[model samples]
Target: MSADVAIIGAGYTGLSTARYLAASGVEPVVIEASRIGWGASGRNGGVVSGKFRIGFAEMARRWDLETARRMHDLGIEAIDHVGETIEELGIKGADYRPTGSLRCAHNQVALDALRAEADWLTGTLGDQAISMLGPEEMKAETGSRDFPGGMLNRHGGVIHPLNYVLGMARALAGQGIRIYCETPVTRLGRTADGIELHTDRGVVRARQVVIATNGYSDLTPATDAVRRRLIPFRSAMIATELLDRPMLEHDRSYTETRRMMRWFRKAGGRLVYGGRGAFGKADSAAAFAALEKAMRRQFPQLAGVAVTHRWSGLVGMTMDSLPHLSRLDDRVTFSLGYNGTGVALASMIGRHAARMVLGQKTDAGLLTSEALRPVPFYEIREPAVRLVAGYYQFLDAIGR
Candidate 1:
């Protein structure tokens, strides 16, 4: 088969790329290794976080003020794009709700930093989408007195992750976009005239290709470039059995501001809480134990709640903590690395990549300004991450 464009991995990034490309009168085909929404896009905390791993102050410090502001706009645009798509496409099963989100500070120092961030957004960037919650308000917002304060973004919400991606696949199909499920692209070859993708079923040739595999980049032999550029870490989550009452006052998404973080929300009348897992383990016994322990530490009242489900997924982390499009070759482009905050970013990055592929104007500040460098100590990243993660956990424990 031959086409103008072929996208790899039918996750949020891939589907978003196809959807936007088709909207522009360009037909694109998507190839997935497994069923649709098989990656992190399908299984996440479901928080619509338009946030970056790097904060506004730090981004400005690293670059310039204008660049930081542009990145800020891009984050907001990402979450907005998701909300608009759900409504515009009329996807009912997505379970989207603009309940807003709270970023809890486990310590007073963290609370102050959160306030400073809010000030920068409002005072510097003129972004008032977020509000600062004091001690009293934090308790009310989080339903826990343990939190000192938080920053609330009404734009951030929750969704049924799997359903969102599936709905997107259906919408793309409605637009004549072909999605080949369980058809893995085994090999990628660069042709003199175009690119060739050797899949399990057949070979496909295209003028250009976008790699949207994200955390699953290493699974495909053709994604060697993407694999080295990303640091894949495991994230585990658990869901409590049906609760007799609501979890929180507002029951929106809640995330703690820390190095080794905990994020959770209420979905399907269950408390879905998640956190970082050891890089060496899978989604079973050992991994879920850490998650349940952390969840219980936060909400010990739920210790008696039965855990109905547990799972793990790889989260691709970038060196810069910014989502980017690296065009190593004109015919090949790679888009990945949301740094674990991709619930809303998946579509946003996809749109940016699609526009760049179309040669249209895109507001990609530092995202495309440079190519991604290889993660340090790539040869032994698992043990390396363990060392770093242990340090971060210590800092977070001491309230640093």
Candidate 2:
């Protein structure tokens, strides 16, 4: 084999896996369809969240409470792992901040639910810094009175996502990990000895192959089992061309929620806000208008903030909301489907993939504890998701 392992996609998962492989004395080759950070890793909301309890109950039921908690802790550990890497690698371009995150409740019902969630998180997750804020407190904290109350998680934060991915690529490439940009893997099949990665540029025969293509799952040949287990969804974001002094002084960008969830941060004189992208191509005037309207509702001071850029990326959603990390064959393995929290979870998953490839096994409850059950009647998932997502946008316009 030319290389011990070949990882497709130079996004967060692929870059992290390459780094891990290098550290473990295995040099892997990475292929990117476009430039580095071209996928969802470069685009999505740049928030590090510990609230990925999506299907928390189901995961607990299947893996036991202890394993579930450990898995949850691994998500938190992923953030720390990224932070440690940033510091160790001396990556300074990515404007990393630990200012924490605020989850706003726009209505009484949402506020009540947030309060309960805060209490539950505090008690069960050993998280205490989560504090509930009233309307006045929310106003004071965010310089907006749009939300009645919210919960602040001090452990969470945000970063310049594109820069972070690029830094990771540089770090891994410096370690002699072969990273090929503008190279797309067309197919992956069984070879005589191991796995073969067929690409547009060349074929890479490796002893092991890691499918780090999270959002671009369709790029790979999905067997019938996988075809039924995962689906791709798109997310969109827009940024204003830096707010004026009044808005800047009055507000510090914070993640907030009403009918639809939004993640935002004030950087480079612009307010970057992101949420579920509308159906179809990313460039939607309606989506940009929706974002602008939401921003105005939150901060009325900046009603005419000009939008500078708008973009979108696909995210892989698994049937159970948890990812599946299993060996498809003898020498091939994959870990994907972040469900929308890949920014914080991909690093840890990549680390685990490294361990899996090295045959150094641990608890392994992070990815495989839950069963890979497809969503019942998932054939209608795409169109149904589009309809529901559009409805949310319409409903959010009315602040419902």
RMSD of each: 1.4, 2.8
lDDT of 2 by residue, 103-134 (tens): 88867777887787777667776767678878
Score candidate 1 by lDDT.
0.85
In candidate 1 the C-alpha lDDT for residue 193 amounts to 92
Q: Which stretches of candidate 1 lie over 4 Å from their true place?
A: none
TM-score, candidate 1, is 0.96
TM-score of each: 0.96, 0.90
Cα lDDT listed for each candidate: 0.85, 0.74
Query: Pick by lDDT: which candidate is best?
Result: 1
